[model samples]
Target: MKRRHFLISGAAGAALSMARPSWAMAGAPAYLTAASKEGNSTWLVGLTEQGDVVFELPIPSRGHAAAAHPFRAEAVAFARRPGRFAVVLDCATGKEIARLDSPEGRHFYGHGAFTADGKLLLTTENAYDVPDGRLGIWDAEDGYNRIGELPSGGIGPHEMIRLADGSFAVANGGMQTHPDYDRAVLNIPSMKPNLTYLDAQGLIVDQVEPPADMRLNSIRHIAADDTGRVVIALQWQGNPLTAVPLMASHRRGEALAFFDHPETVRLKQYAGSIAISSDGAEIAVTGPKGGHVLFFDGATGAPINGRALPEASGVAQFGDRFAITLAGGLLEGGASGGKMLDVAGGYSWDNHLVSIRRV
Candidate 1:
């Protein structure tokens, strides 16, 4: 089957307007950025507190994910093309400030974060056909220059998080695909997935792999706590299709333990996007295939609560509230399909950022 084109065009703009609700008329823009899968563009949909889109700004590429600088108002977005780099957009003007590309032809695997002082930008890159990936370091303050690339230590380098201690923790999902976007003859057999730790200079400081029994569980996204404890979300790749869900943690060169999701077999198709609360009190993981966002007590890995969303993809934590992006019901299904559902009061089908505050 031909892969679906994920871009929104000028013609669909009118239909998108019709999908807007009356509630979109009032309030402050609650969302900062929205990734429009159908448009293959990231929209700066200005929103109000009342969950309305005030205005819209189109980004340059088909951005899968974005990271807002911790201190500055700028953000960096990643595209899927190998050897392709990220684009820096001015949040205030919605203009492209810089285009950061990789020299090694390694496409960024959709993840990036700004350093504490806002001087450094860290991102992940993976070769579509190669065994190993790379960690890219860039100078954020100076035109987003490529400083160097670090060994990602695994197959598919998906996401990375900066720890409080200044080290970096990366979740390297072990799977190789065709650089030309060809799925035929692409899926490799018995790929080994692992987690790697590195310092600011990109040297491998530590690493961890899955147990022999669960080698196919690819560690993809990750979130870290104040104490250097890293929580990894796993995506399954192997067969049998009926196996336990493996979620694990790593800290100080020791693997604490791994917790299995109660509904492992049922959650096999879910892509894991993990987030830790700002206070380090709660850890949340979104399973889009399972239609649920599962939360657990940070310290014990015990289940706390889980909420159902149409198709949750991204999860983030503000001060005391948790925010998530609900894409359309189907992962690859386009907007015209009946599978897409309208959000209660916010945006639709396209990626929307919504926050729920704790009472």
Candidate 2:
């Protein structure tokens, strides 16, 4: 169980130079990211729209999510939250391109996004010393160099989505933590999570938080459509028996609207991931702890469908349908049909399926 860290070797350098023009030779995966585990080893996986693995590159540890280069056959797999390493892979050649190491006193939150132009990489980070959330900017053309940073407008920022207008919508989870405590929530009772919208330059354009009584809901995952409508998946830190909505939708200049689900469709107060359909008409959120996936009408904030699945975790948009993965390695769809494909090699899909749609 030796740890693997990919550096920029000569072969990897060659792969990087030809990555853009020859990506089709790399299988041209439609949905780029989802991590899989095989015993003690983990890999950053790329899949076709039909859920076939196109490329699998070994990573240092478990990856929570990945950020795909908009047009190149490159991807960055981020380590689990509070983990400091993110490996950049040359998917076209199945080679490790480079690694991003968070600066001391700072750690990644297991998610990132590439600017639409593919020139910059933005990763959600925790400046743990100040206990503040940050967006670490990287120079994509310059070996993924750490270029600058921006305030995330809250405490613990997790997943982020890039809007069509070149801004970003960040789910600031708001619970403070440090490596010393190892994921322990230091401020749950006082935690105040918000969805903060920022421009390309990282200035807060707008932000929204839950109403007074719903403050304990932690905004952890986020999804957005082309029209700028954003959906959020929340993890409740309050009493598990308390009935509360686990998903919400919002647009700029409008109040946050939480989707209502039947009591029978209990989300167990946790939503691991959220995704919106291509047409922006439907939304899906997964509650792995509750063993269910729930869909909602994107515009009206109404629950459309719910299904029970064992260990349902990562979810993403697959054309007009939704692709979901369970902890047992089942890749399936919802509403339209079921069971796209199953991953082999003792690999189980991890949290957060990211779609690598063309920019």
Candidate 3:
């Protein structure tokens, strides 16, 4: 298979044999995201692959990340960090089916994933007092109850994904915070961010840390393609004026490779979200702080294009184009440039948008 490479537009020419995405094979794509308002009210919205809003369910409070079930129309909307609850909604009916509470002395980390079989929901959490990162396991079929927890391998673990081989790739952000300081980072000078691989049984099998110079570049969000190759987005805790690699790549056992940008000074020090192109050959990293969705070649990790999007952060792929959620609506961007989809509604989209997919 001949793979076409573009810096920001990766999935342009890669064939199915090359991308090998099971969800793409199944057809009819959809996505889920948590949107909110200033009044503290929130919602979990679902959208068709064409960027049309399909369903919306009111949530109890603010939300950050969400996980959609692979085989069913169900989603778990997690409250932003320091929050203690997650609501499981039946997307087919827009009804709240269950509410997951953080165990005492712990708080939800606002991101989670379901196993390949959809039996357990794994959430990142910060253990109270002790202040270490933990993955809370919820039995999806058993009323979404807290069953147990596993070590996150680092502090302040943020986003995680289930890989094709059934192992989990977790981005342990490593910046400890307590509700005490209103989410103020406490370990910027010594934060040890790492990409950790956890097996089905929740055991850490491998780990890769960032280079010494970029230690403050926190690995915050992550996405994996068909081959289990992961691209990580980071939030820099160092001086904002110093241009640094806000993205990197890692395989299970290899050293994490930080990417260099041609316009380092122009790259936002913070990446709110990241998405790998269907062919796994391109990457889109959104920087709402800088108001642009920067695209890169997945293979070479070089800058290809940077499209200006006001408050552009949320991003996901439907088929050929990337769907980004901003206050204006869902914007579709590709080789031809960016345009808004005709999706309508009162959605105040958040920092991240997720494509519904198979693990």
Model 2 clash pairs are: none
Could you tell me which 10 consecutive residues in candidate 3 have the lowest summed lDDT? Answer: 1-10
Lowest-scoring 10 consecutive residues by lDDT in candidate 1? 1-10
**Which residue ranges in model 3 land beyond 4 Å of their true spot?**
1-29, 38-40, 263-267, 335-338, 357-359
Model 3 Cα lDDT, one tens digit per residue, 1-359: 11111111112222422332344454443777888756657888777767766677787777888887765566788888888889887665557888888988889888998876666788999985797999887766556766677889999989988898777888999899988777899888789988899876677889888889888989999988888889988898988878788878887667888886664445478888888877656688888787777788877888787777777768887565588877667787753476787667756777888776533
Question: Which regions in candidate 1 have their CA more than 4 angstroms from the true location?
Answer: 1-34, 37-55, 81-85, 128-130, 183-187, 264-266, 327-359
For model 2, what is the C-alpha lDDT against the true structure?
Answer: 0.78
Residue 269 lDDT in candidate 1: 46
Residue 47 displacement in candidate 3 (angstroms): 1.7
lDDT of 2 at 177: 97
Instruction: Estimate candidate 3's alpha-carbon lDDT, on a 0 to 1 scale.
Output: 0.77
In model 2, the runs with Cα more than 4 Å from the true position are: 1-19, 22-25, 34-38, 263-265, 327-332
